[model samples]
Target: MKIQIEKEKLQAAYKNACGCVKDAFEKLFGEDVLETAKPTLDDYKTIKSYEDACDVLGLSPILSENRNKALCAQFPDHYDFRQNMPKHIIALMKLEIISRALWGKSFEPEPDAEGNKIYWYPWFALYTKDEVDRMSDEERKSLCGALFGGAGHGAYAGFGYLTADGRSSDSGADIGIRLCQETEEKAAYFGRQFIELWAEYLAYGFKVTEHLK
Candidate 1:
């Protein structure tokens, strides 16, 4: 089956999600909160790496506190700043992971050993189309649910490691679903949407839920 993505529709949905995040942030933290908390490039240069920036800037306390509060609102897990991972960095990680999983088809990654550069495939590309078609309705639903993972749910999905050959050696590997050549337009779309999605995630502390709004 030929895969087709509605780029215009996706753009609109991404814009709407941005708006939702903007509104939520403005309502909860005031309009200028981000500007107030903005970190400068000089500030970044003072730290050894992005992961350690929060520790140097004393942001670890507030960010980790808020994150743990958010997590506690949903789960019983209690998180601390001992690991040097800040909320903003974690937010960036979440955005990058979700965008790569969902919008990766828009760009072409480096080719694998077989000289195949599968662009624009879902993370769960392990199953063939025929295999997917053979599954019962209930099974398909469950599979899709698992593939989507904790994208919009209460938790965030963890990383899926790839081996040297770019194949899944572990359980949650990112074997792409769709394969196609990347275009300039698609690359631009991915770049723009990536920034928007990252900003939205930072502002609202949630995954995008309005895809077609």
Candidate 2:
């Protein structure tokens, strides 16, 4: 004779299963942490393998043998979760939040009518040189806050380059209000903000830094 499981017991088991899955993901991916690495436009393109890219960026792979084993052992019911989920989902999420917070825009992926993926373009990479020059210094500073702010800020900036043509500051003003928020407590907040904004102008292939002064 087969024994029937109680409803409460089934619910508890399901909750435990989800917790185990989440814990397994954390252990396998190491909390989805971001690291800063200064990659030139070429470096971003040269790497053909994810392992190579991870090495260049000093990022550990979210799916390794040991991490996978830990996940499988902890969450037997959902051992295939990592494989089923796209690896870039976390990176995309981080980028989405940062992009929206800084640019007031979203990074939309280009797709065909059939819903097949085509390309991903960051909002900044689409800017014209004239547009970059037209933007105020305050706006540029916010986009490039990583250059002046801490490592986390730099990581965010580096991640921005993952999208097509992300290296060009001309498309999107890097500096503005976010930089102010990032360094509000510093004594030279205003000065640093200006400095960061100026750097972005220079990076955007500008000839006259004095235009803003």
Candidate 3:
């Protein structure tokens, strides 16, 4: 079926999903965890200067020169602004909510085979219900697994987040987020919940409307 989702319905579904995640974080960790990890919208910005790049989520220069050789080396394709910046920003927003859910608990630090620290991060992406239903399990893994930009790749089409176990986090920003679960059993339940949500709210729209048939 061609799943149709209304804008208000989609927004509501997302809000509920976010609430579920937020509650799960509180249940696993504590009430204050997500609150602390949540940042003001201004926290991340696309700026013209490389000096500010490190301090922001992304960088888009007012001047072409601002995205210098160093930034090109650092952020690669993402340093420059694109038509898809809004989508990218939205992904980052969802990531924050999910990451905050992970905050407050401590997971085991998984080291690489070489004993180097392997940083794991959650990879979240939104697909239409019809889009997700068309893909096989393997296809889903291959496609949505790492939709985020990797260390050196371009912003959109390169690679996504790193995963060691079922879930991961950057050791630098908030290690405790990964450790939010009070018990090891539920350590990374957020990953499962999001994947089951089946393209976030798109699935919910179908469920609520009984329109999947």
Give me the candidate number with maximum lDDT: 1
List the candidate 2 regions with Cα displacement exceeding 4 Å. 1-42, 64-88, 91-213
Q: What is the lDDT of residue 34 in candidate 1?
A: 34
Which candidate should be chosen as best, given TM-score against the real structure? 1
lDDT of 3 by residue, 1-213 (tens): 877656434433343455577566557545443332222223221111123332343323332333356547765656334334444343343434443434323333433434344344333334567887899999877765455334233221112234453233332322223323333333334434344332332232323222321
Q: Is candidate 1 or candidate 3 better by TM-score?
A: 1
Candidate 3 pairs with clashing backbones: 102-177, 103-177, 105-179, 105-180, 106-179, 120-168, 120-169, 146-160
What TM-score would each prediction reach against the true structure?
0.24, 0.18, 0.23
Error of 1 at 84 (Å): 3.4
Model 2 vs. true fold: TM: 0.18
lDDT of each prediction vs. the true structure? 0.42, 0.36, 0.38
Clashes of each: 2, 12, 8
Whole-model lDDT, model 3: 0.38
Which one wins by TM-score: 2 or 3?
3
What count of clashes does model 2 give?
12
